[model samples]
Every structure is written in structure tokens, then in C-alpha cells.
Target: MDSPPFESFSRVLSETIGPLFVSAIIGGALQGVIGGQAIYYFKYNKADPLVMKCLVLFVWVLNILHYFLVVDAIFIYTVNGHGDPSSVSRLTWSDIAIVLVSDTGDLAVKSIFSYRVWRLSRQWYLSVAIMTGALVTFSFSLYLTITMIQSPSVMPNAVGTFGALITLAISDIIMSVILAMVFWKRRSVFPTVNRVLRMVILYSLETSLVTR
Candidate 1:
């Protein structure tokens, strides 16, 4: 007898594709928030230079592209591969291609933030360290993206995944600590100034934690 409709999809969801689908859904929702914010910024952003606006638009474009890719990826598994149980095991071009967009966006944001940090602290060493961390992440992502493109059926390497996570964790820790120290060094004698700086440090730490 032929299997019932959605049976394969149900199985995949129950077994393998559930987490990915949930993540995609969450990402789509976040993208909506980003789109709204982008629109708001464009409407009210009179002070930002033209170049900065363009940069924001570019990043927003990447986010939109990533959202579509995520949708397409799920669509391929649920709609295109509807009857096949093994389709979820195989990687699609979308899966491999997403790394490029995601990594490029991440690198751009990190580079911008690190550049600003360098401007504020004038710390060449901290900038270099952050850049080096970003480089490690980009290298691993590029390698994985290429490897998957060449062999779509190949599963991700454990060592590569671990290395990437470790590099990211180390980088975030360094960034959080270095930023706190930099701000702390600028502490003022006034209680109010010190309180504001402490709040900034706390916010920075919290932001890093979220990214981590």
C-alpha cells in the first residue's frame, strides 16, 4: 500500500528535521523584526551619512536573502521531497550556500563593531585579536561550505564543528573581557560617571553572551 500523505514529513520532523525547521521559523520571525527596524531607520535616519545608510541597507538585504534561503531549504524537504524519507539526509545547494551569506554578514558586523572599538580605545592589539578570531570563523565556514558543495552527501565533520565553536567561544570571551577592561580604564572619579560606565560594561557583557 502507498504510504499516507505527510507520513514521511512527520517522520523527518519527529526524527531529524525538527530542530532545523524550528530554527528557520525563529529566524524568519527575527528577520521580520529586522525588516521593520530597517524601515524605521530609513525613515528617521537623517543624521547618518549616506555610506552608513548604504551599509545598513546592505546588511538588511543579506538578512532578507538568508530568510528566503531558510524558507527554500525547508520547502525542498517538505514539499519537493515529500514522499522520500532519505531526502532529509542529503544536503541541498541551499544548505551549502547559506554559509556564505551567513558568514559574510557576521564578518561585516563584527568588523564594524571591532573598528569602532579600535576607534574608541585606540587599541591595535585588541582589534587584531578580534579580527584574528573572525578570520578563524570565516576560514572554517568557507572550508565547510566548499567541502559540502563538493560532496553534498557528506556529513559535517565533528572536529570542524568543535573547532568552530571553540574559536567562537574564545573570541567572544576575549571581546567581552577586553571591552570591559577598556571601559574600566576610563572610569571617572564621579560616582555618576562610574555608574554609567559600569552599566555600559554590563550591557556589553550581556550582548556578548547573547551572541555566544
Candidate 2:
């Protein structure tokens, strides 16, 4: 018997496709922002360190790869494996790949900010604390990826997933607060510095909203 209308499509939609679509859209926009920043960096910061330039290029490449993987997965489901029961019923390797790539991208971004926090505050202890949280989050993410690969038929452990998310959120919030405080402290030294710091503070808060 033929499957009910959208039975396969709806199953995939609810389980994976829909969320991936939304994420792709948002991630694409953020990737654009990063691209713009990269161009600006090259144009204005010619004297910046090679490591900093390479970091921007690395993030841009990862973001592009992440989006490409998502699109490829969607194509595989809707075109290559269209109406295949097996395809709609369980998570594919592509889905797992998306998760892994996303987690890696997140870690890269967080690590960059952790370094920024250290540079701004010059506080070794605070930098270590932030990186400790990041390391825990990365460990949990790795665990989730392994479990997903091992048991694609089963849902991931909710507690572990949520734990990783919570740790990431807390770490981001701490970093944002530290950055804001550092900017505030420097705001009094020079009027030009105060203006730049205000802009930095605003950007930090705006970026933090994504965590919410």
C-alpha cells in the first residue's frame, strides 16, 4: 500500500528536515556577517597577526561547509532517497554529520571569544574558567556525536544533550559579561575608546541574544 499523504515527508519534516531548514537559514545569515567582517579585517587591519587572519578564514570555511552539508542532506532525503521508507524512518549519517559540524563550529566561535576575554581582562584565572566550561561542552558534544553514530535508531540522551547546551549557554554568558566589564573599565581612559567600547558592548549583547 502506498504511504498516506505526506507520511514519509511529514515524518522526515518533523524529525529533522524542518529544524535543519531553519538552522540553515539562520546560519547562512550569520555566515554572511562573518564574511563581511572578514573583508573588513583584510581591508582595514592589514597589520593584524597572521593567526587572526587565519582564524577568520577558518571560521568562514567551516560555516560554508556546515551549510553545504545541510543542503546535501536535504537533497539526499528529498531527491535521491525520495519515498524510501528507510530514509524517512531513521537518522542518516548526514544528519549526524550536521550535528558534528555544528558543534565544531560552535566550539570554534566560543574559543575565539574565550581568547578575547583573556586578552581584554588579562586575567589568567578567568580565561581558564571560561575555557574549562568550553572543554566540558566540547566533551559532551563529542559524546553525543558518538552515541548518535552508534545508535542511529534511538534518540540521543536528553540529559546529556541538555547538559551540553546549558554549559555552553553559561559559558557564553560569562564571556559576554566579562567583555562588557572590561569595556566599561576602559571607557574612562579616552573618549574615542569609550565610543568604540560602547559599540563593542552593544555587539556583544546582540550576539548573546542568539543563545536565548
Best by TM-score: 2
> Which regions of candidate 1 fall more than 4 Å away from where they truly are?
1-12, 36-54, 189-193
Q: What lDDT is reached at residue 137 by model 2?
A: 80
Q: Which ranges in model 2 have alpha carbons more than 4 Å from their true place?
A: 1-15, 189-196
Best by lDDT: 1
lDDT (tens digit, per residue) of candidate 2 on 1-212: 56675675677566777787787788778877878987897899888678767766777788888888888877777787776656665667777777667777777776677677677778877777767777788888888888888888888877668977888788777777777887787766678878988998989877876855
Among residues 3 or more apart in sequence or in different chains, the pairs in candidate 1 whose N, CA or C atoms overlap within 3 Å are: none
- Candidate 1, residues 55-164, lDDT tens digits: the string is 78888998888878878888898889876867877888888778878877776666766776787799888888887887888788787777777777778765655666
What are the Cα lDDT values of the candidates?
0.79, 0.76
Residue 95's lDDT within candidate 2 is 77
Clash counts for the predictions, in order: 0, 0
